[model samples]
Target: MSKLSLAELVSMVSETKSEGILRPTTSKDTGRYERTGLAEVVNMQITSGQFIGSRVPEPTYLPPHWSAHIHPEGQLYFCRQGSPRVVTEAYLYRPETLDKVTGWIKRIEKLIADQDFPVSAELELFIKLEDEDCAYYLTISAFLPSFRFRSSTCFARNCIGTMSNFFPMHGSLSRGTLDSLVCVFMHAICDQMTSRVSTFPYSKQDCEAFVSLLKNSRDHLSDGNIVCTVARLWGIICRNRYLTQYGQENSRLSRDQAVLWDPETKNRWVSTVASRISFRTSDRYLAQLDDVFVDHLVYSDQWKSMVTGCLRDWRGASHGAFLALMLHIFLLALTPCPSLAVASASLFVASLLASTLLLNRYVPLQGVTAEQAMDYLEAVQSPTFKFQFVALVFALPHTLNLWGTLVLFANCIFMLATNFGTGFAAGISTVALLAFIAFQWTTSDRFNLSLARTHDKFRAMFFRNPDASYTSEV
Candidate 1:
């Protein structure tokens, strides 16, 4: 028998993938352009068909620390993440071009580094956005050190609080929060010379990263380079507006429309992004991107494959949390075995506390003020979880069977306390994993502060009744 060549094997695989089982007859799996062919168009250019040159223009000397945080995604941008934090008053209703807004942002970042904002600077600017950390993302990134906020969606500060809630980890939330100061407050703020810090909730990574991605170019971006590149990317997206699912009033431009930066599309895109200066004065610009398209097209990635990946991660997180919850209840049932009960309860309660705190942080509540945001932060910063742990313990046991469970619960808590010393190292790792997974699982919007959806999800999960899938715009 003749051995099959590599080419033959690949051809077979490609054919099989094209003919997806039970796929609609209308589907054309074997289109002329294959995945690799499309990738070549987006990622690589040919040098006389001999050598493949990268289409992306990334910088070469990226710091060792920053290397890991970089995601070299192409054909899309992170702006589509839909503004995770709060977009404060300054940016709203300001008909500023992308050039003007980005210039202002750069000025702020530069001033922050210099630590000296001149009196002339109208400096107070904030783009507040909210982000939900979810399960699959956290689990995948769990092994990083205490500063895992970027590497994992897990907030390191929560590890101690969650762990101490059930098992009394010798570590304090104050210390954990303090220790993770770099990740929480200082990651992306570093100079280009510093090691790269990972940015989490990947969708909302700074425009610096998005700039490199849009160029299909090198890593190790400078501030100037990032601005110019991102400006161009924004321009390109505008040029290709018809391609987007976003409904433009006149979707078809006859290569003659003069809007948003310049008479020609190419000039319009690049003119706004200035690396060395503040917002440039310009006349021709689009009136507004349709508000209806903002969430999906303007602020979020609209790719099908990426969309599918999101759903998968969302479900994984939810299931992971549900599993942890079930295990907690199971351990409650096993309270007769003090050692076993204490160990299992530690995992569940830690996860429960972590999820609760994440909910408090991300889910918006009516009438929230900046003061309340501070209050939330301070509450999480507390060094001890003893009160929370004891309160939770007292609440759960009596609901099952008053007398026997009460006795078992008392014995377990007592034994746990007597045996517990600050198991700081052990506590951090355990709770970090559990909290990361549980928090990510719970924060997806369907069940996140969404009363009706949360109700349906729990009922379906526990009662064998199913509900329609919920997908959020952000």
Candidate 2:
């Protein structure tokens, strides 16, 4: 395949009106360009083609090697999966020229890194916008490890009271959050010489291995030549999940799928990603990216197919269900009958809970055959077949039987009023008041405090003992 010069590729993207972010990795030989670092573009390049002999001066608004079309004023977003802190928004800059904007972004990255921001100084490029209002925000809002938050009093912190609910590993919510994290982690580990101690707790094995790898890289090259090893690692994860869908082993696990990322084999992966697929960068300067390197980074022969496939699947699966459920809930609210409305409300709440649990359970099992897992999940969650019961107690006159009696009594009073009986209206009024009071008392949350307490206490006992390990161990 003919390799594309950066300018030719940029020209093509400009012509196509593609929406993407260009991310390039730093290399040793890049000089003044090095300070320009990574850049973000919005939409497609406003213009393209070689500037070497062209009378037109290189567009000052354009970043050096990266371009994309995004709202220049929007915040820069950063994320990583499995890390305690995932989602972040950086200030966006609108520069006089696209190139200047790109330079400023790189400078900001260096500035942030120097300031000791928790995030890596390294660059990532992105240029995606939410197509519509969504109920679920998918970015690494879920999988971030503990300690990211300063207080446990906020709504999200309170919701994450237990670790089980902390990460929605699988489900529609997984991708925007977890996938971003995965990419972030790979970029940090591979491109930056950060250690686990400064950020996350790491095992000695991984730390030593990584340090040794870094040392070896330093020995082999200088002008800032970092190997694409980290990119290769990312390719492995992405491809395994994407191409062979090994991660979807529950559905298919053919030998073809398993062949996606075997570094040990003769099938050495190539870095030809941008050649095969269309990609663009964001204009958000803080999300610095180098287009040329990003092309190479994403185009690992070892796992390019898998990464692209994963993107397709993640996007398709994430947004569709979120939209459907939001619509369903909105529609359900229009129903009229109070009793029916209450029932629908209960159903909605139950459905939401069930979805959360199911998503949590599916995350870790992505790479495994899910026959037994699915069976277990179904068996445990099958409401119809599960042996369970609910007892509802109604106060006097509010009970189904009592309510029927009141209806009959009211009818009798109306019938008798036509005949005789002084003070009949008063009697009927008293009965009605008594019935209302009784009904209210029975359903009152205050009356159910004990029941709520019992449920809470029971769950509390199992709080730290997720997986029911205590029961088995005991």
Candidate 3:
């Protein structure tokens, strides 16, 4: 049986904007492409009959070699590799076809570097049979995602890299990607969906819709694009939610006039939409679920990073407030438990160090000027920053008082009263260890429960069965 080379397949995939990863199963051992470093090993995806939607379908994993690395250069792909015939939007090359691959590689390199910002490309590949033996092939098509910059410096919103560390805090918030992190996030969340709607290689209607949206004004001042931006944002949010919840993938394009405007325009539109409501009325509605909204926003990476950056300032304030209390406690213990002085001091010192480290390392609060310190606190204290604020409060009492006070209290009660110094010390140590274990168990269990519930609710809200008749609420 004759097999196609990696260069041949990639050439076909890149030019067509096909969707799917490529993989090579060679009859002979293939060596690396010396010039381009394209894997001699062929590993990619193919789009063909029945897989015609813009959203890519998850494919069979060809172990050992198949991965996203094949298409490092920007291009699209669509190929079906199971049979003798392969259809790719990319130009096909034969084994030892170096020039074609080289030409395409240079073109992709230019596109990647020429962009003022970053881009995430969507590719599709399909495989079909010309004859019963699969002697001939048919079509491969590629579609590239539209990219735009949001006014905010929100890092890696829809990128793949962000998914590992964060979850979406807002409903239907789709990020505009311009970097690797955003790509990674999309790859993990959006890219993994199974399309239930239409096939790839858009129908005339899909193409027309995309073109119409593309032609619309990019400026926020224009009202024409507002609906499209809102739809696009909702589509992104809904699409991702659908994918994560029910593993279904559908082309995000909708027949509705909305869902295709510039990203920046969309952000402005959302604020404008929210602003239509009077503050008196809006504030009342917001106040009812304000805690929920604040919790989601503050617990997100946006708030996490903000609080973490200001940890030093928080530490200084915390220490200043609690240091006197600690010193007073130490003085009081000294008279009642003279023999346990060293233990008490050790506990107090450890407590302070732990508190300082928790603030500085986790949500640091130390060393800022009074103004910056106060400003930082105010920001954290804001309703928009509620989750971090809650976390900070929960942490304070434990770090400042409980750990040290409990330890010192035990030392005084056990060692001084019973005079069973060594035995009591060992018992306290054992109990502390057990307490730590219990803390870990409870914390992990609670987090797991909360996560499970959140996922269930998110799924129920957005991803009812395709057969289930429903309409968009807003």
TM-score for each prediction? 0.16, 0.17, 0.27
- Worst 10-residue lDDT window for candidate 3 reads 161-170
Ranking by lDDT: 3, 2, 1
lDDT of 2 by residue, 1-474 (tens): 445433343233233222333222111111212234355433433346723432443443322332222222222333333212222222222342333333434443443344443442122222222221101111222222320111111123223221111111111221232334344444445433543212221233454565465444443322112222322333333333343333454422322222233222221121122112211111111011121011112212212333233334334433443453364454444433334434433443443443344345444543432234334334432234121111011011012222333333444454446445648766776887899888877787986997788877887787776457657777
Q: For model 1, give the 10-residue run with minimal summed lDDT.
A: 163-172
In candidate 2, which residue ranges exceed 4 Å CA deviation?
1-61, 69-107, 116-407, 410-474
Put down candidate 3 lDDT per residue, 1-474, tens digits, no spaces. 234342343344334432222232121111212224353444455566443444454553322221221222333223332322122222232322223333433344353344322222222112221111111111111112332111111122342211111111111212332123233333333322433222122233433454454334233312313323433433343333432333334323321112223222223443334334221222322332232122122112223334553454446535643664466565565545554545545555654665565564544333333334435544544443332333434344234444456545665556444555667667767887799887777677787898789977877887775235344433
After superposing candidate 3 on the true structure, give the runs of residues whose Cα lies further than 4 Å from its correct spot: 1-239, 246-336, 363-400, 406-474
What's the lDDT for residue 413 in model 3?
A: 57
Tens-place lDDT per residue, model 1, 1-474, is: 344332232223223321121111111121212334333355555577675655654553321211111122222111211111111212222334333434433433443334432222111122221121100111111122321111112233433111100110111122232323224323333422253212121233443565345344333233333333333333333323423322655442221233233222333333334211111111111112122122122222212222233234334433454464565565565444656555544544443454445344344522344234335434532233212222232222211222223343455554454456436435654675698688766775755668777677787886553433332212
User: Once model 3 is optimally superposed onto the true structure by TM-score, how far is the C-alpha of residue 464 displaced, in angstroms?
Assistant: 48
Better of 1 and 3 by lDDT: 3
Model 1, residue 231: displacement in angstroms?
A: 33
RMSD values, in order shown: 31.5, 26.1, 23.9
